[model samples]
Target: MRRVLSGLVLLLAVLAGTTAAAAEPATETVHYTFDGPSPLTDVSGHGHDLTPVSRFGGAFTTVAHNGGQALVFPSPCHAEPCPRIALRAATTTGLNPGRRPLRYGASVRLAADQTTKGENVLQKGFSAQGSQYKLQIDGLAGRPSCVLVDDRRPQIHAAISNVGVADDRWHTLECRRAGSRLSILVDGVTRGRATVPADLSVSNRRPFSLGGKGSYPDNDQFQGILDEVWVRIG
Candidate 1:
């Protein structure tokens, strides 16, 4: 009878430990549909909303797309202090999943004529400052790419897709970082993949940004339309 009681106690302890571990805050999601009347509202329940920054009064607007409204970026500028426009989180808190798995992406539409050397879709932290995780369209090809910088060491890993998304059509682009791999997916299809440190972590004070980094020059401003944007970390 004593042995049976001890065994039962051990089983309950094990079950309780497992349940507690599962209840830990290991997963978080923030989503911006951009379909609502106010683009700052976060529909993902995590309440990671955004604040807008623009150089011009009406540089950024919204248009109907996918049966709902979508955010539109400003046109390309070749001069200094151009019409800067972007959306940024009020704070960086809980947005960086550190070394844990992370996925971020957006539904984008851009014309070939609007393509630039680089168009930042979203980013947190700067590569030169500690660590960062970013998604962007690169070069005149308007190729989608994902970049991850490790805070444990000086490392910048990127997976750039060959598929050009700039053709005046809407496309879903996803950037995923898991374990030792960084991948970019277009329309739920894998387009590129690369390797990185498995235990890397990215933590920085920079605010999470969309469309561009701010009004600063060479901000990698995005020029196009963005529908649903989301981030998931675990």
Candidate 2:
């Protein structure tokens, strides 16, 4: 009987050890909390520290929720050049996971502050002519539109015309990448879809950012709330 009991104890101990070893540690999540009726100061988890891109008085701010954060950028950059709030990745370590055929995701609510510029919106990824991919949302005249640039050539093969989420409410946005096909969904609906040949070489090396490009000094910038930006690999 003693031998039998000893054997059972050994088996249990081995099982426990195996369970502990197989468990995966939780990934760290960073949050930049905010409250309504207030201005922004700092944004976190961008992998890099942030600096105000415009001379505006406030920084990007957020509100805390469910261990996550809400982000907001105010607009009306009326100067000769539209004002912009930019977020640069801290370091490649945790920011760029190097997952090719990368799966980019986020939830955002945006408006184009194009009082002067022709268009207003938010843009992400690199915009170089022939190397990188760009994902953009153009919210102009209180209308929401999405565009996908598969190659740096500024060749836009797919676009969603009337996204229409101009209200001040929060909207969910998601993008999926597999091989040469890039699919996009807004507010949980399929808005725009495109397939790019692998030869184009759209990749996951360049860092992620918010705010419009500065190609033209008078381009538009985004205004409103941006929340729950994340990336997932499946």
Highest-scoring model, lDDT:
1
Residue lDDT tens for model 1, 1-234: 999999999999999999999876578888988876787688988777888887754267889987888988888777665788888887766887888889999999999888888889999988888889999998787899999998767677899997999899999999998899999999999999999988889887788899988866777889999989999997
Error of 2 at 42 (Å): 13
lDDT of 2 by residue, 68-154 (tens): 556666556555444455554442434332224544445556543432222333334444453343344543544444344554356
- Top of the candidates by TM-score: 1
lDDT of each: 0.87, 0.49
Please give the RMSD to the true structure for each candidate, in Å.
Answer: 2.6, 6.7
Poorest 10 consecutive residues by lDDT, candidate 2? 114-123
For candidate 2, report its TM-score: 0.60
